[model samples]
Target: MFIALIALAVFFDFFDLMLSGSVTAALLTSGWSTRELNVVFLSVTGLGGIISNLVAGALADRFGRRRVFRGALLLVGLGTLACAAAPRMEFLIGARFIASLGMAAVPGVGLTLMNELLPVAVRGRWVSASGVISTSSLFAAALAGYLLLPWGGWHWMFIIPGAGCLVLYCLTAVLPESPRWLATRGRHEAARQALSKMHIDEDGPLLALNTLERSGEAPVDRLFTKALVKPLVLGVVLAVGFNVATTGFLTWLPMLLLERHLSISNTLAYNLMMSLGIPLGGLACTMLADRISRKAGIIGAAVTALLLAAAFPFTSGYALIGTGFVLQVSMGVLSTLIMGLYLAELYPTNVRARATALSMATVRLVMVFLPFLLLTLLNVAGVVGVMAVVVICLLVIVFAMFLLGIETSGKSLDRI
Candidate 1:
């Protein structure tokens, strides 16, 4: 079941990861100005992702993780197909947004569900294991774009994920609702049955008991209350900052390389190198997050990202390309480390899904504006100048960590 759930999580995420990159090159060639469309697409995709996050999280809390999880995959499939058949830029933008909604749920609900299923002993490890899943999705997207583009064009991108999602929907019938969620809603008997079936021991009862111990009435307000003011702000602001720095850097990487005289094929190869770095980073973070601090992992990653953003425009030839690859690898790990652990740590099981969804939504919102805004900034000041600004932004993230962020390396969601 753990393996099956992980597979499901990875499959859906792979589909989402490729949507933007696969279409990116094609968009540049579609006679539409890639710059403007990228801005619109990034904005719409991020906005849509957040909306889906909220919808999926709330619905999972209300309906059950299995139901919403399966539904999200179905939506991703349909949305991908929508992208494949979209005729105009407007239609493509809308389709991407729809896809964002579906993609958004896999993180918020899927992570929450997985954490609930696993024991604390291996929770951080298991969560970090999703890094491999994310890495595979990213790699597969790159392979699909590299191989299929010459044959069927860009539509194959969406078609493949759509097909995969259809298969996932069929397989989803066997997955159980999250036991924690069931217990939280007072379905103790049902929750116990589910746990027993999975051979899970009743370690500390469930979240319901924890809630009872904390607040005799309810913690309904804790999700948005003063006690959690720090976490709430930290989650949104960190996500926004990270997305801006990462996306702004990645979206313009190839162009920056091109400016330094690398060919298209060379740039693609460089990108593949960067993609390889993501999982390695995730693995490192997974190992360290449980031992050190989640906040430290984020800070380390951001600082590295800042340095890489600066280095890309200065070096040339193999050094420049090598540095780009290294930067990407670190950024990928940092992103997964922070997003997977930190965001999940910010909310309880009851509002975990909602809190995560909102954080994801904020990232998407940043994506919408950052891509366009950064590009314009680049046009005005060239690649070096643009990266200098990003360095400052990344510095701000480090400062935020010291001020607002809490350590959640080995903490449980209920306590966090």
Candidate 2:
């Protein structure tokens, strides 16, 4: 039940993230928005994400994971509800920005809580497993777009996830604070009580607490010190590289297909077919997450994705869909390892959320400019040119993983 709840949190995060692609495509087809307006919309959403990630990290570190998680859900719910009722492109963009404030932070907080709560030996697998559930959201979004876009239009897409988030917010009341975080803050009794909720014995909590380094200095300040700075930098590099590739490829997929002369229905159909790889990639990560070093997994998956991306521009019709499916699978593997396991494992309990959020903030910061960048690439050199850029980002990821990646598989969160 505990893992399931965390999985649901991750599911909604990915669901919301994936919706941007579908909603933008629908808006374009419906004549409600133009390409230029879409760029502004995406940029504003990214801006909101940047602000929310930093603030959410500090709040999670200062308050408790459970509290911040619930609060973020409420914000996402309210903002998404506003989006559903938006009357114009301008209002939708504003609502999307508001939704992003909460939407951006959900997965990071969910992963952090899972890292803190789960046992060390099984942590990577369970975290990756949650990603299996989360990645399915990609397929869910695609499926939703295919069904709802033609019949009910884009409004249903926002309405469903918005309502779902509100229900999930209420359900989060059953979640416990992170025991390791409590222990680091010197709240031993509270830590033990949290442990009890997990059915962990008192001795289990005591032994876990013994290994934790107590909180010191401001969590934000400690992030830049020598010991933490390396991982922090690595985290930022990996995140930026991944986001550049994904935000460029996945978010722009439908538009790219449309530019190829595919009709809206055909474009969405291709997307639905390609999205199948998301869950498959997550399943692969679940199988290999604990069996191999995360560094090895990231490098391998990135290389595979790079190869697939290079092949993308050369394929047509079913061939294009096949290449994309394989690419999504490879990306799915990278996503689970990097976001679900590697980033959270790099830091200790006290500063984990802040460190993760800081790295993620870089992702959003890059996102702010990506719409313009990708638009320029698409217009200048076409999809081939756009893919060349994705190829470059993947190459960077592979090089960085080989050079700076740390192995955290099977290591205790505190020990790392």
Candidate 3:
């Protein structure tokens, strides 16, 4: 039930995230927004994410995961409700900015909570399984857009996920705090109680806590130390690379398809079809999570995705959809490996949430300016130009993984 709730929370979080692509396209077709205004919308969302990631990470580490987790859901739910009622593009943009705060933190904090709660032996598989469930939201958002946007029902897209998140907020009241986090904070009894609630034996975590480094330094400060600096940089690079490739591609794909002379409904249909690969990719990750090295999975997926993306501009109709499906599958693998597993495992319990936040903040930071780059490329060199940028980002991931990738597969969190 705990895993199920965490998965559901992540599902809504990603539903809102993926819904933006179709909503932006709808706004464009409805004459409610321009390309430039869309850029502002996306940038503001990123900026809000930047602020939320840092703040939520520190708060989760200090107060408790359940507090920050529930608070983030309430914020996102309220912000998305405001989005559903927005009458103007500007108001919608403002609402998105507010929602982005909670959206940015939900998946990361949830992953952290899951990592700290689950046993080390099955951690990778369960985390990847949750990712499988969450990835389905990509398809859900696309289907919602396909069904609703054609009939001027774009508002309902925001309303559904918004309501879902708020309901999850209430449901999460029974969620326990991370026992590992509690132990690291010197709350051994609380940690034991949390473990009991999960039906997990408390002896292992309580014993591990005795060996944990109880430093007085700030969590953020510890990120800069020599032992951690390398992992920190690698984490940021992987995150930035993944975000640039996937977010940039997914956000712009519908518009790019529209520019290719496809009708709005057809474009959405193709998007929906391509989105089918996401959950499949997650399933693949769940199978490979413990069986393969993290570096190998990330590098292999990046190379395959890069090749598939390169084929995107050369294809049309079913061919385009085929290329995108394969590309999304590859991306799903990267998402589960990087966001679901790797980033949380890199740091110790003492600073896990904060470290993950700092790494993920780069996603928002790059996004703040990514629209400008993509737009400029789209204007200058067309779809091919924008894809060229994506290719470059994927290539970087491939190289970085080979050079700096730390193998965390099958390792206990405390040992890592």
In model 2, which runs have C-alpha deviations exceeding 4 angstroms?
202-212, 216-219
| lDDT of each candidate versus the true structure | 0.70, 0.86, 0.88
lDDT by residue for model 1 (44-129), tens: 87777767876787777667877898888888888878988987778888888887778778766766777777666677887777
Model 2 earns a TM-score of 0.97
Q: Model 2, poorest ten-residue lDDT window?
A: 203-212
Q: How many steric overlaps are in each model, in order?
A: 3, 0, 0
Model 3 spans > 4 angstroms off: 210-212, 216-219
- Give lDDT tens digits, candidate 2, residues 1-416: 88888788778767877878878877888889988999998898789989988999988988878888888889888998898899999999999999999987888888899888898888888988888998899999999999988764788888878888888998888999988878778888888898889998844533454433664225467888889878888899898998889877887888888879899899899999999898899999888899999888999999999999999988998899999999999989988998888889888777888989999988999889989988898899889988988899999999888888888888887667
lDDT of 1: 0.70
Local lDDT at 330 for model 1? 77
C-alpha RMSD by candidate, in order: 2.7, 1.5, 1.3
Q: Over the stretch 53-93, how does candidate 3's per-residue lDDT look in tens digits?
A: 99999998888888999899999999999999999999999
What candidate 1 gets wrong by more than 4 Å, as runs, is: 30-33, 150-152, 212-221, 258-261
Q: Could you give the candidate ranking by TM-score, starting with the highest? A: 3, 2, 1
Kindly indicate the candidate among 1 and 3 with the higher TM-score: 3
Better of 1 and 3 by lDDT: 3
Indicate whether candidate 1 or candidate 2 has the larger TM-score.
2
